[model samples]
Target: MKSKKIPERLESKRLLLRKLNHTDAPGLYANIRDKEISRWLSGVPYPYPKDLALKFVLTAIAKFENKKRFTFGITIKGIKKEAVGVISLEKVDYKNKNAMLGYWIGKKYWGKGYMTEAVKEVLSFGFETIGLHRIYANVYSENPASERILRKFGFIFEGVEREKFFKEGEWQDYLTYGLLKKEYSKAM
Candidate 1:
């Protein structure tokens, strides 16, 4: 399948996924600055600085433009001004037709089904629109919510990389999940 260009916006029943921009820095910082949200994210700093958030937004934009990655800011449909979370298909390998999925939501938004909904739409965009053969995600072994979301989308447990990441001053186990286009199509 030939890949299609990612749309400027993707809509779900209650949320909108759009490209990250400079204006999202404040909201992004506010949401991710929480230790609860940042702890599981190996790449994010614990005390996420405001400037780092701005730099992230700018970097996301650059990466999107370069086709290196596609990052989306998640906002409620009626409240699009602020992003409550972020999702991305990073480490894209066009030749291999695969990418790694990563995402996080604010502490306040936990258990609201927002991340699940966003993941569904993004998976569709990845496999159907982007013609990706496989989309995979890594979850901290201790984080069941993330593992559940991936499993809900038909992501099969691949394996565990023991102490693969060192975050918050300790080593963390990483669980890998993967969904092939065939599996995703069957689930849908």
Candidate 2:
């Protein structure tokens, strides 16, 4: 597959999405370690490991350079430079022009519409910058809030993946959502 150019920084009305690095470890760890934030998240470990944030940051940097994935740390503009959330487009399939979208915000920042702004910018980057034709998201059945966000962004509910993952100590089902480039255009 050919290499893609992923922007290092993207700006929205109230947030800045930038490439995550080692410097973000402490802030990322602190924000994501909250049970409220990590509970519904699939990959994140409960009682998150002390070193996991730094490891993820390093992996994100390497993945970007490899053109395999693009992960951005989300921070509020002019409020603090530290990351309060994370978003990513991973498992890129250049042959099919598709990728999976994943994101999570700190519990303290919930209900603020910060994630909505971040998602908009990332969607634009995925469709316009990286030329992806489809972006999909998998939301756990229990996470209605995330599903609502997906719906608001024009993502169609495709189907459910039953017992798809073992997360937070139990098996969980996932509600799959997909948004095509055309659908996003129409939404806009």
On the 0 to 100 scale, the lDDT of residue 112 in model 1 is 87
Can you write out model 1's per-residue Cα lDDT over 8-38, one digit (the tens) per residue?
A: 6889999999998888999989899999988
Give per-model TM-scores.
0.96, 0.95
10 residues in a row with least lDDT, candidate 1: 1-10
- Point out where model 1 deviates above 4 Å: 1-3
lDDT (tens digit, per residue) of candidate 2 on 1-188: 35545579999989999998799999999999988877778788889998999999999999988888889999998887988889999998999999999999888889999988999999999999999999999888978889888999999999998998887678989888999999999998
5: Cα error in model 1, Å: 3.0
